[model samples]
Target: MRMMVAGLAMMPADAQDIEPDGPDIVVTAGKPLRVDAKLLRAAQRRFAEDRPAHAPRATLRFELWRGYSRISATDVGLALTDGAGGQLPVTIDGDGRVVFATLPAGRWFLTAPAQSQGMHLRPIVLSSGTSVEDRRLGDLRAQCRVMVAMAKADASLLAMPLIGMFDAIGGCASKRFGFYHPVEHPLASATATGAGVMRTLRLSVTSTSYEAPLSDRNLPNDARVRLAYR
Candidate 1:
C-alpha cells in the first residue's frame, strides 16, 4: 500500500508562541480542606457525566524551552509507569497537553523517550479529584517535530485543511517539508525554520499507528502507519 505522508511544518517566523498566562503558584502542604457533602456529591456527578466511566482523571501540561525562548512541544511520546511495572503510552496533544482519563489512583512515574529533554521523570501520586497542571517539565532543545500520513488517494482533499487545523490549534505556522525514510524509499518530514516564536503546537492524525523519533535517533524498523476509519 502506498501512503502519502503530509508534513506539517510550523516555522517560528509567522506566529508567536504562547506562554503561561499567570504566575506560577505552588500548592503547599496544609490541613486537609473540607468540602460539604452536598457539594461534593454534586461535583462528583458532574465529573462522572463529563468523563469516562469509573476512571480517575488528571491533566499534565508541558512547556518546551530552547535557551530563553519557549517553543511548541507537540507529538512527543509520553509513558506512565505504574507501581505494577505496566506502562501506558500517551501522546502530548497539540496544546502540549495530556489527559489521563482512565488511570487508576496510584503512584506513577512519567517519562518521555530518551531523545526528549525538559520533562519531569519523577514519581507522581494521583488520587480522586486531583490533577496536576502547568507543571514545568524542564528545558529542551528543539528536537521532535510533527508528521502524519494518509492514503495517497486522500492527500489532495485532506492536505490543506489538515494544515490549517494544526495551525489554528497548535499556534504554529504549517508548511510542507521533505524527509527521507530508509525502507519506505522516500519519506516526507517537515522541518520548521526561520525562527518564528511559537508557544505551542498541536498535530492531530487519524491513523492506526504513528511514531515520533527522538532527536539524533534513527527511525525504528517497526513504525506502522495505517488509516483509521470511523
Candidate 2:
C-alpha cells in the first residue's frame, strides 16, 4: 500500500507558544519541585533494502482547535523509538498530522508531543500491508488516554486540550459513533491555609477547547496546545 510521510514541528516561533490558560494551578509550599529536560532526538533509520513485507508505515492526524474553528500547527515533528533505543524521524503538517514510511513491522512507541511541551508517547503497532484506512477512532482514543496518563504521571506540569480533543475525537460527543464516553469531572481550584503558601496541585482535566469567560470572540484566539520545558 502507498502511504504519505509528513513533517513534524520542532520549535515554536516565540514565547506565545506557551499558553497560560489551562487547568487550575496549586503551588504548594513543601512539595518537591522537579525539573524536566527536553527530549534528545536521534537520527532516522537508514535501511539498505525496503521490502514490502517488512516495510512498516503509519499516519497521525490531529484536529487542532483554536476555539470553534479548526486550525493547524507548524514545524510539528516526532521521533519514533523502539524499546531498544532505535529512532525514526517523522514529519507533521500544519494540521498536526503526519504520515510516516519505511518503518519496520513490530511494536514501536510513537511520541509527538509539541515542542512547547515535553515528549508524549503514542504506542503504534504496524503490520504489513496496512494503510491509513486501518487507523480508527479507537486508535486516537487510546493515544489520548495515554497522553492524559502521562500528564498525571508528571507532577511538574499539565497538558491542556489534549484530553479534551481526545474527548471530541474519541467519540465522547455521541454514542451513535460507537465511542464510549467515560465520565469524569474537570475542575481547577486552589486550597489555602492560615500560613498562605499554597499546598497541593489538584487539577481536574477536561476536554474544553475555547477559553472560559467566552466574550469578545477573538479570531486568532489562543489555540489548544501542549508545553514541554524545564
TM-score for each predicted model, relative to the true structure: 0.24, 0.25
Q: Model 2: residues >4 Å from true position, as ranges?
A: 1-60, 63-77, 101-103, 112-230
User: All candidates' lDDT scores?
Assistant: 0.28, 0.27
Across 45-154, the per-residue lDDT of candidate 2 in tens digits comes to 21112112122232233322222222333443445667688777755653354444445556564443443242222222222343222222223233333223333333
Best by lDDT: 1
Off by over 4 Å in 1: 1-67, 71-73, 120-230
> Residue 78 deviation, candidate 2, in Å?
1.2
User: Could you give candidate 1's per-residue lDDT for residues 1-230 as a string of tens digits?
Assistant: 11223221222322333121111111122321111123212223334442332123422233433222233445545566665777777555554554444453455544445445432111121223422221111100011111221112123565666545543653211232211111111123222111232122222221111222212112221111221222
lDDT score, candidate 1, position 164: 52
Q: Give, for candidate 1, the lowest lDDT window spanning 10 residues.
A: 135-144
lDDT of 2 at 127: 29
